[model samples]
Target chain A: MRHQTALNPREGDVLPPFEKTLTPVDLMAYGAATWDWYACHYNDAAARDLGLSAPFVDGQMWGAWFARQLRAYCGPQAFVGGMKLRYHAMCFAGDHVECRAVITSVSPLADGTEIEVSQQIEKAGTRVASCISVVILPATGVAETDSEHSAGKATEEGIRT
Target chain B: MSDLLSDEIRALIGAERYYPAHEEIGGAAIRYFAIAVGDTDPIYVDDAAARRQGYSGRIAPPTFVVETGQYAGNTPSANGYIPHEWPWPKGFRTIRGGQDYVFKRPIVPSDRISVRYRLESVEAKSSRDGRGQLLAVSLAEYLDAAGAIVATNRELFFLQPLEAGQ
Candidate 1:
């Protein structure tokens, strides 16, 4: 098992950003599974009629993407406690979307570290999904579990690892 | 109120599963999701860096499968997919109520996987303020290439029916 990341002050927190393109297949697959079958997602003509150049990706799908990004920094011991996202604009299929996140606040808690992170999903420089993630990190001074172990122990137990 | 059994809605939920996509799981799909949501952690992008940090390599963000039905299952729809029945009134917006995970193993790209989804269950309620509904849970199970279970996904949707322009 790994130890939780020690709380770092944002004064020196640095983040890496990257760009990715969503294939029409990816968009349709997500929509089909999530049951969020708004026509604008799989129907390009409908989307264009709605003012988009092509089929749009669902914002919830974008939100799910944001959660995964935040967890990368928080690590295996990271627990997403809360998440909220606002769809600022349309992200059409096959468009290049950029993702980025930065640590906003890190506070030590009784059992673990509380982290607040801000994330954004953009398309061709337009913001698609912008959101905040609240997570609980594994605490310091805890015994390491070399095998399978839940990352964050329930508050009832004294969490040292 | 409990209109789930209504013939119209069930027809939508019972559509044949769409093509379940094959994904590396930790690939760009995850990165895009992260970026769209605004996370910039190194683990999402750098394989060497994540290995240095003790992970085997790049991995799908925790919610990687939220949108992919390979893990959530898909059904063929004669009338098209009906989605979990939603019955909210006015200013109706929905969101993730919360999520809990029991990771049997951390997902790694080398692991071949797929998901099967079931509508699971639904709940509905009504009041004078208008009408409302909740998708208490939509359950999904992840399977390795050999057909071993890897993870489970349960999503909740809170629906508000009345508000304009949802």
Candidate 2:
């Protein structure tokens, strides 16, 4: 789907934050979706046996949240080329996690603009994970007027994730 | 550089094991995953919306490749997904350290992906509490029917020895 206004992101731009409260149900569904049925992610008893107070969110699930944040900030035509995620701490179910990103660099490509985004997932003020993502935004029509385009930042409220 | 890695484990480095093709990516699976991740993107759920975005059919979320093996009943052992044929050390707890992924192409419905796993490296490191930990780096390549890699995932796992007593 074509975005009404093309995104013209600049370096140092911080994307709008995406937040979600993960529950045991969310963890189970994420495990089912990713096929990462590790007991610590779903079974509370198993998690306690492993020294955790409760089942924790799968580290890989943060990657999906990062992708969702980028898709929300760059529009649907953008492609997520790569991502590097480093897990710092365990986030248990019921924690409210906020995903945030900042554009580190923006380079012009022949057909699109390549942007490196530094992303992080924070829970209760502590960083649970950090990520570096590369996204390629397709070269499309320029904004008809400067006021018409907010570099994709104006639609943050419309983003569901 | 540490003696934590046995010769058997060290020998696994650079060895690649290929698995059979996974079940075709279907619209239902894509939609299910999208919903699980709380993504309401229409391109992942509606074929018509995807076609409008230049995709032939509904596309999957970028990380969906991680689950393709599960559909084929390839449950992961303690060694991680795409297990090695050799026996892994028992009584060690496996912890995910990090993950890196490079997507070369978008995965769409009906795409049957074949996968291969390679042990990239293993090392001994000290955990935050000074316990000796064995770090294993594994690589999984998801290939299309044409044998071209569509995505590559590198997983970092830390195997920590279990302490005595429950």
Candidate 3:
């Protein structure tokens, strides 16, 4: 759960790329729990009936997966501002999903560090999920070390104003 | 062309329901989601560390929204699992295509989060394999306690059948 650094991406600063091989349990879990019981995510008969190659994974699952991928690089306090992903290919259960990211650009912003992240999730070299993440890092002057981010981003407000 | 189906789908957007998840719920979701990702951030846990960071208390991980909001509009399920409950012929596979999320502001505790859902549009397109398939896409807006738009979600799902044996 402890996070890694995502602020500076040097030429070879590639955090370990991740590959997750999903099982039917993964798909079924999505269906049963997260209100995502789409047969393509679980039932093979449903997949073939619907004209898919195999039972695919849940998009919401990937939502979390994408966040996890970024978390791996950005450390804990990475504030995701805007996220957009296009699903290019189908990710079937039992397929090893490879998720990765490259820090496309890092710039200092008024509020904090602006880290624009380019992300990809591939299954055997085929892109499954491709995304761009705009994350707000701790303020440069304030966040001297990753430990400050360990708690969470500083907030100006709580539940009750 | 007729927008009848589009209109009908648009009508399918139901009344908004605000699932009031408090700090505990926020913390639980952050824990679960982090567990799924194998993250061990103090923000996710270690309240003392959180206090040290001047957060007052621990803050849930960012993607905690998925945990708090992903299953927002679930229909009842026979099993223990949460079902998508989309009105379609039974036994069709559903695959989430993608999402476009715009976070107007960071999520915080005590916020009465409400997701306003609308059927953006649905269209039948020819799959890469040359088969005509239905793509149902919807949009949901996450509103804060004061009702300001916190985030906008545009999601697409490919409805198909499950594949052959595992």
**Winning candidate number (TM-score):** 2
lDDT (10s digit) by residue, model 1, range B99-164: 333344546656656766555554565634656454455555667777776666555554434333
> Comparing candidate 1 with candidate 3, which one achieves the higher TM-score?
3
Local distance difference test values of all predictions, in order: 0.55, 0.77, 0.59
lDDT of 1 at A43: 79
Decoy 2 TM-score against native: 0.89
- How much TM-score does chain B earn in each model? 0.61, 0.85, 0.69
Candidate 3 local Cα displacement, residue B1, angstroms: 12
The best candidate in terms of DockQ:
2
Which has the higher lDDT value, candidate number 2 or candidate number 3? 2
Return the lDDT, model 3, position A96: 80
lDDT of 3 at B71: 38
Each candidate's TM vs. the true structure?
Answer: 0.49, 0.89, 0.73
Candidate 1, superposed: residue stretches over 4 Å from native: A1-12, A33-39, A46-52, A141-161, B1-61, B64-79, B85-166
Alpha-carbon shift of residue B94 in model 2 (angstroms): 1.2
On lDDT, the candidate that comes out on top is: 2
The lDDT, on a scale of 0 to 1, for candidate 3 is 0.59
Worst 10 residues of 3 chain A by lDDT: A152-161
Relative to the true structure, candidate 3 reaches a TM of 0.73
Candidate 1's error at B100, in angstroms?
A: 15
